[model samples]
Target: MSAPEIYEDGCPICKERLENGSDVVQIRQKGADGINAASVQRGDNVDVAAGCKAWLNEKFAPDLLETKQDVVDNMMLHLQNMDENLHKGHVGEPKSTIHQLELERLRFVLTSYLRSRLRKIEAYFPHLLDQQRNQTAEDPLRLSPDEYIFAEEYANNMSLYFRRVALRHMPTAQQKLDLSKTVAPPDLDAFVFLQVKDRQERVLIEEATDDQEEYVIDLEENSKHLMRYKPIAPLVSNGAVQLI
Candidate 1:
């Protein structure tokens, strides 16, 4: 069965209780079979919305984006609260079933989002690690703390495996993993479908063919386009456009 519809009304489960002076927003869930609306806290709804957007961005971006640690953490907290509440309700109840379905859906989105980043890290660990090493204190971190550890361990293990399986047998001069020559970085020139969130002026589009001259175009707000990722990379990171 489909999950219940969540609206921005107030949450039914957590009432309007503020924690640590945090604003308490409410959400209304419309049951699948036209049952009455149920309330839920506003925090859960906001975090879930952010989590879904982050998921889509991670899925579409060629390079790994900054980790949305706060969004993930908040969503996880909400999921835990929902799970505890569900456990208190009887099985076979329509409300419980709806809650269960919605919980599963959120889990899937969060799982898929994390898995996408892990796959990218696995594919470009060496390059990603190098980037991490070179980043200054002011730069935003590309990997979360856990992910950074995973990438480091994965890089070390791969290096060891290569040495044991083949590198040791090579000539001493050749027994090295040259990351610059061995690792393939993500292709920023790849084309992506995106929707513009804000109007952008004089966005440059480099010519693919040598014979063609480069040109610039304006990206109107709310318009969709297929374009190469490189020139618009900053726009995506700054939330001006959403990759489809």
Candidate 2:
């Protein structure tokens, strides 16, 4: 998020001390001895009002500048934890090939999710700071900034399980059919197969019928291996196309 703008507070002493004009006034400064107050004598020739005004302005300006620095530090600290965790996930002793790929995938998923969510936050954060400062009626309908961040993190964590288990357990099956025909498999199966001609044109062909009995091949599901032979072009004929 872009840093919050700092607001400068009006000087207290200028408003309080110089409200009543005086040639000499007491200014307090603390030191080794507590409550070290001193009265600086000023002549009527000195424009004491302008000097007091400048002093108060100078004192408050640093405070206003420091507030912006504090906002930036706080934001950096908040994002730093996420960065450190993701970095640790990637760097370490060598792991098993499968385990390492899984870990990298998880890191990619989570970091991508965080970056996407942070982009949204950077867009909306100004309105949030305004709401906090203005003390307007809180909207019951909108998700707060904290709630939005939490929800995005939660979704990223949940998707890991979905990718690991649900996708891994996808079923594979083969069947033998009584007739020789090239068409889609029975509607009961999970997917449909296509034979790609060039990169663009695809010919929809049913899986080869099982030679043994009434069974049909699921070209789409079994085809995931990419190596096995179901010579698509070889199987093509007048009405039947090759099942590459």
Candidate 1, residue 206: how far the Cα is off, in Å: 2.2
Tens-digit lDDT track for model 1 on 181-202?
6878998888999999999998
For 153-209, candidate 2 gives per-residue lDDT tens digits of 544454455557564466443232211132222222222133432221233334446
Stretches of candidate 2 exceeding 4 Å from the true structure: 1-95, 130-244
| Top candidate when judged by lDDT against the true structure | 1
Model 2, residue 236: C-alpha shift (Å): 48
42 Cα displacement, candidate 2 (Å): 78
Most TM-score-accurate candidate: 1
Would you list the C-alpha lDDT of every candidate in the order shown? 0.76, 0.31
